[model samples]
Target: MRSRSSNRFSRPSAQRGVALVIALVLLVLMTLLGLTSMRGVALEERMTGNTYDRSLSFQAAESALREAEALVEANRPTPAALAACVNGICGSPNPADLERWLDPAFPSPPNPGGWQAATQVSNGPISLTPQYIVEYLGDTFPCQPGNPASTNDCKRYRITARSAPGGDRSVVMLQSVFATD
Candidate 1:
């Protein structure tokens, strides 16, 4: 009897650390799970913020594109009217000529100092910045007689507008087409 009792007591004593080890392992696993969850939440927040920024940037770019299109359409109805559209001389109706319309010094109407325009010239050899460019797409020739033969001279004009959102310094480009009537 005495031997049995002593054996039982010794067994319990040896097993004392077993429960502690199991508990420690469980605690470490729980901590890792908690940390993982926290990281996931942080990443989600970042993605949401980035998505919002991109959405706003896209809207701004679209707005810029619309503004540019209006200018092009105004000039299109009558080439002679182009002169009145500008402060003075009509200049050229080509892409390079459009750059003059995007002066940063000129404030956009309805929202003073909210938006500024810059033109980049990208044509053969001239390398001038245009606020917008006019181009014809898909083999449609310009209805006007005696114009150069190219994809651009057709009845369609491609206007591109660029703007930086929230002062982030990242530029977004938006393009739209207006018909030359």
Candidate 2:
């Protein structure tokens, strides 16, 4: 009969370190996977933050636009003043190509520069104070049949609002052509 020691089951001496090498390789691979996942999460978070900042800027700009419309509706500017759009608000248009608001290179002044700034807004996290400009389009007679006396007049105004968080990285520009009462 064969001795039990002669038939013993055991790994070869040459392969003794194979299990240890496999475990180390697996550890490295798992570490790499963890690092890649962390990077992806970080990138996603940055993108989300940018989106939120942009949204805040847009909201502020919208508020400025509404305030401008109120001024037009109230007819705050006199007929003479409307004829002479002073500051950024123009009663009479100078020239289409000369419009500063249409140009991106123009240097906008601080709050109340032209369009009134919105109030009650928290400039937190993202700080973008909004400002606006009003352009008065010429007056048009509403259905002038014959006598100009009986015809009503319609005034047109172009309001543009620029909203930027304090950083002004995400500047939001909005424009609307509003006909006044």
Candidate 3:
């Protein structure tokens, strides 16, 4: 019964701004989701970078350990000569001496007391060349069966190596023992 023109133009007053409100709410939710995802991605990136730096430091320390072992094998240092620790070779570690490596001042100052630079190159680039120290742990006679002591004994050396990533963000230390006849 109503005219066709009037029906076409009729709209509910209550629904006037409903569509706009809905659109604005959706936009806000989407923005929040985007920001949260971005934060998660950034955190993952930082974690990955730290892991890489730590792995590099570990490899560098290992290389330094190998170099120190080679030195001990080649030189076959005597206990008497180790007292002076010439070129990173050291005598038995006293409590104070053992703590020296952990000291912050000892490494950067380049103390000649015991630390030695690694001559071998690492697989990856490192900010600091690794350093190591070889400590004479006395003699052991592994070949002589049943006899705890023997004149034919092998010299035992404990080598400790340390390396740090760029900016000193991370540090790695490794220890190994080498025995030579």
Candidate 4:
């Protein structure tokens, strides 16, 4: 009876810091989770910014190409001018003449120094600058009336424009053709 009473009176040993350890572990896990979420958000923002820059660059390039094509069409030189040239037609107006036609008075110069001249249609000319790079590909092959391979007297031109917005570069290409009818 005495022994039983003594045992009942004895206080149970305290749970040695188990609660503290659990609390610390939980805190560490929560901190890690928060940090990971923060990192993910930051990465997403960066990606969005980059995408926007690329989009702007591509738009600029496309605009440049369109301007160039219009210039080519407008400045188709005389048949004599196209004949003197080698690449396509020396007697007809060439890309160089087209470049010259780009009015400097415009807000942006269509054919800056970066504009390159092509001798033949093939890859055409390329322009490289700190702000952007453009590639113009022209085709003078006339299309055939009946046969797909055969060419008529029409000429085709393609221009590719590439630009970098805030140093983030992108490319845009455009193609067009003119007939001597």
Q: Each prediction's Cα lDDT score?
A: 0.50, 0.69, 0.76, 0.46
User: Residue 13 of candidate 2: its Cα lDDT?
Assistant: 61
Question: lDDT at 160 for candidate 4?
Answer: 36
Model 1's lDDT to the true fold?
Answer: 0.50
Model 2 residue 62 CA deviation in Å: 0.5
Candidate 4: minimum summed lDDT over ten consecutive residues — where?
A: 118-127
Across 53-119, the per-residue lDDT of candidate 2 in tens digits comes to 7887788888888888887888645344335334456665556456756655544655233444554
Total clashing pairs in model 1 = 7
Which candidate's TM-score is highest? 3
**Candidate 3 clashing pairs?**
none
Stretches of candidate 1 off by over 4 Å are 1-15, 77-140, 143-155, 165-170
Across 75-124, the per-residue lDDT of candidate 1 in tens digits comes to 65322322323322132244444353355543343333223344432324
15-54, model 4: which lDDT tens digit per residue?
8998999999999999999999999999999999778655
Query: What TM-score does candidate 2 get on C-alpha atoms?
Result: 0.73
Q: Model 3 residue 95 lDDT?
A: 59
- The predictions' CA RMSDs to the true structure, in order, are 10.7, 4.5, 3.4, 10.3
lDDT of 4: 0.46
Looking at candidate 1, what is the lDDT of residue 122?
Answer: 30
Indicate the worst ten consecutive residues by lDDT in candidate 2. Answer: 111-120
lDDT of 3 by residue, 1-181 (tens): 7755656677856758889999999999999999999999999999998898788778778988998888888888876633756677778767555454676655431567667878544555545578888888887546465776756877888898988434645789999878887
After TM-score superposition, what is the CA distance of residue 87 in candidate 3 from its true location, in Å?
A: 1.3
